[model samples]
Target: MQPGEPSARFVDIELEPGDLRLRTLVPADAPLLVEATSAEPGRSLWGPHPLGPHSLRDAQAALAEWDPAAPGQFSLGVLRDGRLLGAVGLIPERPGSIEVAYWLRPEERGKGIASRAVRAATLWARDGLAVPRIWLEIEPGNEPSLRLAERVGYRFEQRVPRHCRAWEHQDADRDTWHDCLIWTFGTGPA
Candidate 1:
């Protein structure tokens, strides 16, 4: 909530890098998000993220609350050339701080899409959102995510145990108990 900002509502955002484009998430995106993450060799983001088969309807419901022109929680659709890529978030929490997270389609991985989206988010959080701290948490086992966090200028802060819960799998032994690595950027908020 700021003096003047968009009301809590979904935004239509479009970011283009050469031939690629990133836009805000929409309710129609629910199925695509589900499909992308559910596709095989998907061990990438599935383990630690709560998004799963059951998330489609729920994610769609949540789309009503994501606002890009506002100064609060933001969830955006990751789009490239009008195709759904994934999602990215810069959540408002801890006052003057936000937690940044991004997930890309398996086929979209390794193309630096997530990195670019993250960089865009960091810039937004810093300038658009006027936040001092842009933080992110990555499951210890997700090396690529960790690299993205670091590559985006987020520095290693601390390890928080069981900081993330993986609800996708039925096997408890999947050790869904994740150790989270916290990364901070720009001198973090006081």
Candidate 2:
């Protein structure tokens, strides 16, 4: 959707008392976001992004679309004590489904941060946005991410070939699509 066009879906959410807050990404978070996403681990998963060189502009662009007056495919910074720990977002991937994606800094791993963030965002999509189905698609080899999805009650729905081409740089040719395990929350697993 165009910027400023009303989608009326994404909304701010608070996860933990004052320690963890899921809120709109801000320009100040650009540098940290760039640093996090540019790492080999993150880059391999999210593919190449412009955040490294054009941090401010990139962050602004990321947040610009989610104006309070108009919102769609909103991204949130997972903040702990006002410092960005990671990011989680909900993007409308189909007519009746919203997809979830998340990442945390290496230093932030193993702390349950990703789990909390994903859980909060999924609940917001379900209760706040009244979303009927939430999807979490994981690359077959991403064991940690898959485990996190299971922890949040998302059950395996299906496996699809060539489901995630954007997840890797080599896949840019579209000839190396990775198999993905689709998991769902609202729609019970088969």
Candidate 3:
């Protein structure tokens, strides 16, 4: 990563398949943020501490903070026919691995939008960024997420106990933690 170089290849990438598209997130997407947090405000692992209007501000601030050339952890807005469907993020967690995070609006679920988005993102990370491995951490019992990962070619490796908690439950008791399944995309099954 250089001072002015982008952390990922999202800048040159514009994924558009069918009516769906994935583009680097911008402040203009703040309204979409508001729409997204309407149903589940203050609940996201990838947004502000309290996900809401305040989170929108936070997201805006984050976008402003980045130099655009070298974005660190970046979020991309998922849109269909010019409407926001959800968001996906690429976070370089370590040297050889990048974490893939995504979510879709309730109305957007079950439409295969998320699956398409994940597949596109992983492909970008693998080919564009030359990422050796991709990781997706999902809370236990989240069948949809698990299935999405599986459908996109990720295989379950192990469960990390208390690795993370739902964003809404962050203030709950310490024992109230989410057992996340660590799924990975690598050369072969782990």
Best lDDT among the predictions, by candidate number: 3
Candidates, ranked, lDDT: 3, 2, 1
Candidate 2 runs further than 4 Å off:
1-10, 26-32, 35-41, 44-54, 64-71, 166-175, 188-190
**Candidate 1 overall Cα lDDT vs. reference?**
0.66
TM-score of each: 0.74, 0.78, 0.79
lDDT of 3 by residue, 105-140 (tens): 766789888888888888877777777788899988
**TM-score of candidate 1 relative to the true fold:** 0.74
Task: Give per-candidate clash totals.
Answer: 2, 0, 1
Question: Candidate 2's residue-wise lDDT over 14-81, tens digit each?
Answer: 78776788876644456756555554343411224542333556655655653434444666778777
| lDDT agreement with native, every candidate | 0.66, 0.68, 0.70
Candidates in descending TM-score order? 3, 2, 1
| Model 3 steric clash pairs | 42-51
Q: After superposition, how far is residue 78 of candidate 1 from its true place, in Å?
A: 1.7
Evaluated at residue 87, the lDDT of candidate 1 is 74
- The prediction achieving the highest TM-score against the true structure is 3
